[model samples]
Target: MALNFYGLDLIVASNIGTIKHVKYNSNPNKKPDIKQLQRIKELEKGQGITCMTWADAEQTKFIVGRKDRTVQTFNLITDEFSDTKSVDFGEGKLQSVSVFGESIFGAVESGVIKIWKSNTSDEHLLNTGGPIEKMKHCSYNSSIIATGGKENDLKLWDLEKRTTTFHAKNVPHDWLQLRVPIWVSDICFLPENNGNVVAVCSRYGAVRLYDARAQRRPVCNVDFKDQAGSCISLGHYDKHVIVGTGRGLLNLVDLRKKGKLSKSYKGAVGAITDVMSQKDANVVVSTSLDRHLRIHNAESKEIILKQYLTSKLTCFLLRTVDSFIKQEDGEITIKQEIDDSEIKDEDEPDQEYDEMFDNMEIIREGISSKIEKNIFLEDKTKDVTVSKKKMKSEAKKRKGNDTINDASISEDLIDSPKKAKLDKEEEKVNDEDIDQSIIKLLRSTEKLKRKLLSKNKKKKAKSLFYK
Candidate 1:
């Protein structure tokens, strides 16, 4: 798939207990602008923002779930935390929160889900089970919600009926006859099926797609080796979903191909806590335990922008660029200036590598000495080649002259066999002498090379001693 998103605007929550509003421009020269939106700044991530979801259709307000089991409303226009009255969920981590109609649906990690109307007094309490990891409301049908967690299989709940509509059955036993355990970490409803088809990722590193009408078991289950998926988001393309793994791996999985991985993303160093795609855009925003926010273009699968928020992040919400709050009547709006520290100099080299090169010691010989040695070797080769060529030429001339003299001797002394034979023997002697001279020259070149090398080595040794 191609990542076609031009820009990114989103909210990220760090595990260090901070919520940052990030506005990113596609321009390379400009850095992503981050503004702290949290009223309370602390030194921990769990207690700040654990989960987030948009509260309204206009993407103005969103629901924030905290570690202390409290659900709060945050509006982008007002830029203030409202409806902050804490809930009494006893003692458990707040998993997720979503708005359905006038009532708000909040799920806790302790498996306690509280449902109550907005701007009301009494709230309805329902205990689904223990240790719920994720609870998400289907955008297609507001009343429908999905819940899954560790040891908790995927289940669909109808708010109006207050009944479980679909319960997913686990995969069959493995080859060793061992039953696979259930550990659903995140749930996402596919918009294509009108909330009938759903996708869920587990801590076991598997992404499964279940069709409520087709069967209880997952029709497509793709398992990633050595990487457990912590969160899942719908992909920009159809039948595709982006899965952020527990070991800092972000992968795009195709639902149509039995969970085949289409693309893998880079730049996350810590386990990804959440990955979300902007509606109607190919941009994907992910939060990780590494205390940074990264925006990826899903189509290109390249990390276009990265911002160090200095919080071990848990979750985030992707707000499109068009959804930015504008100046309303009687409302104050001022452009915030970004600090120099917030802008990352990506072109600068790492300090460690720079120091290493700067402190490096030069142990090799001087450059001039190296150059001289090279020149000597080059001259040595040329001299040997020239000598060999001269030797060959001289040998050929001797052989030609000897052949001519032999022919003249035979023609001049046709009757005297002994005389001609003597002449021929003398010519053979001359040829042998020429061959010996050539052999001597070749042998002398080898000796000369050995002497030159020995002299050079001695000079080098003397130079080292003097130094």
Candidate 2:
């Protein structure tokens, strides 16, 4: 799901074989009315939608990756879906999809990444060592993207050069000389830099920061021992990074402090799958495997909005009303400009004239309703109804007609005895034919039974001879 420029929330949720567009009531105090929560529209989906990314800056069009190994485009303005502008990845399941300006990036479970320079048939493929869990395009430099998963640690790739940019070297060995296994779950490019710095979270509960231009080894590493870090998102102004852990903890890491954990937000009961920061960064929204979507205050670390949806939600986008309004440059001005031609005079009779017309409209509507009611009454009176006496007369007439019909039937019955005898003879002939067919079937069954008995006797004789 993606947010539109109008600050209206749009999310695609699963419904049978299709996806539904759900718009939430953004008002915090007012509960969403159930009647208004009707499905906006349903788009046919092959398998389930795995990932989605905006296709345009206005967020009118978005590309969705499905488990069926295909990508589709959905247009919000027209409420239409186009699978024509798609790239198929054979049998691999899509792990993530990203839209970076004119290029589309998709990573799949087969360790292959597909890139489309434009929304056309032309595409390019890049192979990683193993399945990719997450791939994020660099916002600072559109030509760079970061991918990490499974056996593949964090690696930055330059789209223009089509080569690996930063290959993170492992941090040697532990004090006991045990080699750490590489399992990067998610990666994000730092926006503050010129696509040189990147951060990654791993299944080993480690968050590492690597600078592509500077070093092969991670510049900073922090491990939260309790649970694994599944996803990471940058905080406001890139001051801190919000890590969603497998234990449902939101850890705020300060970048200036060498990736130190500053604060923690709690309240989720299951593993956090995804987390997104609002434009202001004051509020962060997260989805968990426990079927809950939560919004938390960044400063106080308090839960602001916690809603439990019945289905397992993987992704969601939030848009606020302030994004639509232009920011004020300076303080409000007391003086304003007005045109004389557009001004209205207080002595004019426009208000009185409008009031008179409104009164006449109300009177006419009332008279039309009264006339309709009278016509309905007249129609009801015109309906014909029979009395009890007329009803009894009709019943008697029907009884007499039935007796006359019965007499006719008796006369016809008496006139056809010869035909009845002939029919009986024909029935007898049919019975004989049925008996003959049954006898033939019985004979065939007896012959089959005899052949089986002969075979069994022969087998017994052969067994005795062998003994």
In the predicted model 1, the residue pairs found to clash are 1-299, 2-299, 3-299, 3-300, 15-45, 15-312, 16-44, 16-45, 291-311
lDDT for position 106 in model 1? 84
Q: How many residue pairs clash in model 2?
A: 0
Q: What TM-score do all the candidates reach, one by one?
A: 0.67, 0.62
State the lDDT of candidate 2 residue by residue for 1-467, as single tens digits: 33433223535333112333433334566432211121223334455667777776545567777667667776654666754445566346788888765777788877788878654667888987777888888868888888888887778888888899787888879989998888888777777689898888888898888887889888888888967988888875465778999899998887665668888899998888788777544677788878676778878888876765545556654433222221237643232223334433342213434566788733455556446655754553333122334444655675577557657676676578885586568656655665565556556556655666686677778896755
Worst 10 residues of 1 by lDDT: 345-354
lDDT of 1 by residue, 113-165 (tens): 88887677768777776579888889888888999888889989998888889
**Candidate that would win on lDDT:** 1
In candidate 2, which residue ranges exceed 4 Å CA deviation? 1-27, 32-46, 84-87, 117-119, 279-281, 319-467
Winning candidate number (TM-score): 1
